[model samples]
Target: MATSRALAQAPPAPARRGQHPGIALTVIAATQLMVVLDITIVNIALPHIQQALNFNTTDLSWVINAYTLTFGGLLLLGGRTGDILGRRRVFIAGVLVFALASLLAGVAQSSAWLLAARSLQGLGGAIASPTALALIATNFREGPERNRAFGVFSAVAGAGGAIGLLLGGMLTSWLSWRWVFFVNVPIGIAIALLAPLYINESERHPGRFDLVGAFTATVGMVSLVFGFIRAAEHGWTDSVTLLSFSLAVVLLAAFVLNERRAPQPITPLHLLRDRNRSGAYGLMLCVAAAMFSIFFFVTLFVQDILGFSPLRAGFAFLPISVAIIAAAQFAARNQVRYGPKPFLVTGSLLVLGGVVWAAQTGITTTYVGGVLGPTLLFGLGMGSIFVPVMLTAVSHVAPHETGAATGMLNTTQQVGGSLGLSILVTVYGTASRNEARQQLGAFLHQATPQQLVEFRATGRLPAPYSSQVLVHGISSAFQMGLVFAALAVLIAVFVIKVRPAPAPVSPSGEGA
Candidate 1:
């Protein structure tokens, strides 16, 4: 912090190629790490948040969904916004917005308030993130400096989620869950303030803002997720649920139509025309759908079921970072030699094995017995898939459209996570509801007066009964994740064609 603080204190001047490269890299990389890590950092604090804000189990996914929905949905548009407006200006504005949103989230007194704040933070992130990457292109000339910059930025981005889990735990355990949000304030402000001094703006490109594309895509996804969640609570035929689904279809259809016509389309529909690229995106979507949900539910299981403290729960996932990095390096090194299909097929199989193993988890499962194998397998699988998918996505892309190709891959990840989590949470919510009903009579018979009182007030069964219900729900959700992992395996084995692609995979961190 002190070293970064000193960098900020230097007098304002645009960066010159050989001038304080470390300072510019630090500012840009820090901003990127902050944006990327926010996807998971809050997971450690979820239990605390639910208790404080009275968030019902079904409603709780919105804390994550809200951020991802806007960020993923608006991502392409954000990158284009940076192109039209100067990257540096958009980057600073985005950072400041993120800081403000963090402040609001920290002070949030209700579920709605926190959700709104989180969504705003997503908007800020979508705006800042693409520009942060673009700024690296402008600040460092293309060569070893640029490659090194990307590598450093990418490393921070890659490690951010694991870092978030640890940091979130420490903050929640030592200070409070609110500090998870509060901690972002100073860092974002520093980034916002220092960016102008060390980073230079890129030349503005002429482009039209794709307002229609962004609106339809974002709203459509929201409606679809809301429909699933509402179905969990109310049932499939519920009027609101049906209406949401109906609107989602209409809006999403219209979105695709708009993209085909919009002069500066947010998503160039043509990116999917290539078979290999499309397969890569599909693989990514399935992989993310499975992986993100595991992160969410497992965080809950470690804390609520296994009785791990927030800090301890955070550390429980540490090995995943190691596993993923090792496997990703292996894949990156060999992809040119062997091509992507073999790694893709093998990786997806690893994921399938992991998720199937995880689906068997129950009330009696221990961390060693239940968590370790799946976590490690999933980590390695993801690491292997990431580099290949990224390269395949951008393969055959025109030079001018390369950024859009990679951006789509990132968008697929966020959107896939949101959609997958929504579906899994829906399954969990319904399964838990039914399990609770089935166990109610038994629980009531043995319950103490105090336990009965607590149950009446909180609608939560104490200890053994609660654990039984949660295990039922979480296991059901993991089973659903298994289906996604299977789909990824199928996609990798049959759909991803053997193609020699020369595209350099952006050192982009695996999608959150």
Candidate 2:
């Protein structure tokens, strides 16, 4: 195994080019879009999945977490496999596996069965995503064409969450919730068949799997996330919670140590040495943490507090999709000219402002006044930051290692999102608990003995107290998000050094 830096700096003697670039681009990007969208597409259908499968309400979260954890954990390993084997071969294999898993999930008779199938789909996604991105880099020249492709890619990446909400709602409303999984069957089949015709295989390299490093990193991330989520559900002082955090620290430390010595490391430590890439990764993690919470809490706020139906709540997210697409297009077209650093700076600040604005929302707040403006700002900020960071992540990489580089980028986003969500949940849960305690104390002084007994029996506070508690919890979560966004701005200003993309190299090993 080679370090990402060496792999990126090296070039093939004769670049691999296939016929019909347009067709190739379509097949590759479409496949990538499908993989990205699957992350959130099933969220809306979770209640349905739970009801049908007879799952406990709390356990239903596993339906999503099982997929996310496996996919994010195995991403680097999958990318490394693509580099050692052929990307085309791995891509087709992933599609086949994903389709099979989708079929299994659609027809699952029990919660355990569904969870297993979802994990399988995630495994396939781990394989497919990085390869699809690398294939795009291989097919298109590095300039306007690639940038345009990346713009579309980034747009879809940002829009995929909103699309999933929309599509999940439609599928659950008109058809059965299972149709959400079933819908992927045809698309996966089409991409599997079409990809071979247009996309050429990447050249293979002899590499060893970094099993030690892989284990440490994956287990560490999973444990850390579990700790935070458990703390949110249970109290922070839970013994299991403390144990999980302890394990995470040890495992993560081991991962760093293993990477220092591994001959063929799964994640090349040198990649972290680049200031621009590091800045991009840090900022992406921060915003993504906030973004995941937004999707989670906003949906709850719309449906639970505002009395919107599920379908209506889903549709309400459309503005985010539209704003993200427009902003992504603009940023993709103009970033190289003006520089990525500026967009990163301004975009992060916008995200911070949006989080602050969103923190002000209450039960009495109107949708247009309280929700739409912040959502638009959030979408635009996401669009502006995502495109440039994606470009920076894979920019200047040599042809051979593009898959691994891009894989690391996608993995960071996934892991970061998961970890961030858990942390925000903890913050929200703490605030809610504090508010509930205060409300209980106040009610004790004012209420009759019978009313107090009724309140204790129901574990319910007064309406005003309940509303204030919910708002405080949500506001606390947003404040944490604001910190993440602010930290991103700091990284962009001080860490990343803006510079020009390297001049294109010709097929004959000379500068174009």
Question: What digit string (tens of lDDT, one per residue) describes model 1 on residues 1-512?
Answer: 45433433333344454467799899998997898789899988888999999999767867877888888887777776666666777789889999899999999999999999999999998888867766766787543455456556545555567778888999988999999899989999898777777787665555567889989988998899788878888899999999999999999999999999988798888989888899888998899899876688888899889999889988998888777767776766666557778889998999898899889999899999999889889888887787677667766665445546656777787788888887998899899999998789898988889888999999877778878999999999999998899999999998888754354556684421
Report the CA-based lDDT of candidate 1 relative to the real structure: 0.81
Predicted candidate 1, C-alpha RMSD: 6.9
What are the clashing pairs of model 2?
A: 8-398
Model 1 clashing residue pairs (backbone): none
* Candidate 2 structure quality by residue, lDDT tens digits, 1-512: 35643543344333235667777777777777777778777888888887898999778988888888888888888888778776787888888888889999999999999999999998999899888877767677668787887888888888888888888888888899998899889999998888777787777676777889878988898999999989998887999999999999999999999989998888887888888887778888888888887787787778767777767878989999998899888988886577687788778888877888888877687779988888889998888888788888876666666777888888888898889888988999999899889987888889988888889899888777788788788878888888877887788778878765555678999976
What is the number of backbone collisions in each predicted candidate, taken in the order shown? 0, 1
Best by lDDT: 2
lDDT of all predictions: 0.81, 0.82
Worst-scoring 10-residue span by lDDT in model 1: 3-12
